[model samples]
Every structure is written in structure tokens, then in C-alpha cells.
Target: MLTPVTDIDGAPFWEYAAQGELRVQACADCGELRFPPRPCCPHCQSFASEWRRMSGQGRVWSYSVPHPPLLPEYAARAPYNVVVVELADAPRIRLVGNLVRAAGDPLDSLDPRGVRIGQRVRVVFDPATGLPQWVLERA
Candidate 1:
């Protein structure tokens, strides 16, 4: 039962997700896209930023399956996947999220065994959390 902690820089991300849109922060100065939103751009140190909608397409860059000793809330969902996805629009911008069966599905809905690095996935907003998740793209 993880919840997003909204901050000055990341609030807009949650706001957009609530509207079913996937957006990332881009530096207004250098036009560099970044994730895990922050007040200043790492590349240009710019305080000015804008939210840019993404194509909702990316590939799994890396993943992990948590084992035991997990928090009680997450222990029941053991073997769940946590993936880092590299956005197709901005390869350098990566977002961490779970792989779900569909929009609004639970984080552990998909079997961990099915997740693979480099697998293409699309973004989906979870209505319950007003946050983004991922779903494998079909051929």
C-alpha cells in the first residue's frame, strides 16, 4: 500500500495522472526531460520546468522481484515486480512502477515470472492511487 508523496515539483505529476495522462517534467532552459521530478534540472540547474505529456510507451530497463522480510502490507504481494522503464520519447528519463494487468489493476496483478528486461510496456494510470503503472504491450 505505497502512496505517492506529492511535493512542489511532483504535484503536477499526480495531478496529470488523476486526469489519465502521463507527463514528465522537462527543463525549460535546456529542454531536458527528467523523472522523479525535482525543483531544479540536473543537467541545466534550471528552476523553470514544464510538464510534457508522453507517448506512454517505453521498455523495461531493469526489474526486481522482492523476496521475504517485506512490509506486512506488501508481503502478501510477494514476488511482485518493480520495474524501471526507459521512456521511448526520452530514453534518459526513466520511471519506476509496477506491471499491472490493466489500468486500475493492482500492482501485483501480473505474475513476476512474465516480466522481462527490454520488454515493451505502456503506461496506465491507477485510479485508486492517481499514479502511473505499466502494462506489457501486445504485438
Candidate 2:
């Protein structure tokens, strides 16, 4: 269940992730960027869309360390950091991911206590999973 579930609308996002590129859908008709890759643009309701590349640099907008009784699949990785990152290229487009010491590192590898809001981070794709993970820019 941890694997991303892809549909026609979201397939491009996952496809880009697999290629180690961070991209978000944009309204082809109006040039408005959007996340969660949908068919219709929330800005203009246009069905035409395109995927725009992102800088993969962002600030830690928020984060949390979940307690027990979480999803059974993720319970073993307790005390992990789940962060919402506000993209430097698109402030309104935020992505959720883990803050790791390095690309491909385990979700809980970094101590949750070390994470904080407004910290600078860069995106790194997990070699095995291709999922986007965050790492402290200073580190």
C-alpha cells in the first residue's frame, strides 16, 4: 500500500519521478501549475495540461512524527518525518515526502527532532523506489 497508486491523471507525475525528475502538471491553456496532476485546471477549468519541471529545491513548510497505531505497513518505520515542502519555483505547489540524510536512505534514518519548519532542503530520488525524498541542503 505504500507504493503510489497511479491513474491516467497522475501517471505523468509518477513517470517523471521514476526518471528522477520533479514535475507538476500545468494548465496548457492558461499556463497555471498544479499538483496532484488532474485533467482539469482548477484555475481555468481547461482540460488541456502539460507537465512542468520543478527546481526540486524547497523549504520545509511543515512536518510531523506520527505515533503508533498508524498504518500497519508504516508502523515499523515509526517516528519518521513526513514533511510538506513549499517549492522554491512554485510557492503554492507543496510536495509531501520524508527528510533523509541522503538519497535512498530509510524514511526514519534522520532523527525527527532534527527537522524544523523553514529548513532548506533539496529533492533526491530513492534509487530503489524512485520516490522523492528531501535532504537538508546544508548537510
Candidate 3:
């Protein structure tokens, strides 16, 4: 159970996650997509924006296995993976999410030896929570 900071700007992202979708901020003025869900697009500085759903597919741009939990809340889940994934649909945008599977189901468990930089992955919604998360996509 990861706890996220939901603020005015980022609330919609989490809300969409609750609905099993990843919604990014797309600037109505320039059609450029942005992450972290801000009010204005950095490219055009336009306040006009809309929510765009992603394909939920991506590749591991970068990854790390925490020897110790970076946050107190994750102390119990130490040695977990945190990956920066470049979404397939949104080529220029990347997202950060937990690589996990359902309880009692060992599907795509994070392996230190198996995971490498640039591995292909896809978004997987946690069946229990119905939240949009990520998992390794088997080739």
C-alpha cells in the first residue's frame, strides 16, 4: 500500500488511478502532454488543459532496488523496485510507479538479476485495489 501526496494539481492523477486509468495533463493550446499534473503547461504556459489517457504500456527507462526503504511508509517493503518508465503512447513523458503483483500471486516479481535497464514493461492494475500500477511485460 503506497501512500501518495494528493494536492490540488496532482489530485486528478490519483483520482484517475483510483479508476484504473493514468491521466496526464495535455495542453489545449499546444497539445503537449505533461506529467505531475500541473495547472499550466511548461511549453506554452497555458492554463487550458485536458486529461489524456495513456496506453499504459512503457519501457523501463531507469530502475533501482532500494536496499532500505526511502520512506518510512515503505520500510516494511524494503528491497522493492522503483522504476522510471517511458510510456509507449506518450513518448516524451515518463511515470514512476511500484512494480508489484497481487497477493499470493507471484506474477512478474521483481528480480534483481532479471530486471535491467530498458526492459519492456506494461501497466497492470492491482486487481484488489483497481489502481493503475506497473509490471514487467514478458517477451
List the candidate 1 regions with Cα displacement exceeding 4 Å: none
How should the candidates be ordered by TM-score, best one leading?
2, 1, 3
How well does each candidate superpose onto the true structure, as a TM-score?
Answer: 0.94, 0.94, 0.82
Error of 1 at 77 (Å): 1.2
Clashing residue pairs found in predicted model 2:
none
**Residue 123 local lDDT, model 1:** 94
Tens digit of per-residue lDDT, candidate 1, span 34-73:
8889999999898999999999999999999997688888
lDDT string for model 3 (1-139, tens) is 5356789888888778777787788999999999878888999899999889887888888877777635776665666777888999997898876666532233236554566778778887665554556776868
Q: State the lDDT at 79 in candidate 1.
A: 74
Model 2, 1-114: lDDT tens per residue?
256788999998989999999999999999999987888999999999989999899999999999789888888989899999999999999999999999989888999999
Clashing pairs in 1: none
RMSD of 2: 1.4
- List the candidate 2 regions with Cα displacement exceeding 4 Å: none
Question: Number of the top candidate by lDDT?
Answer: 2
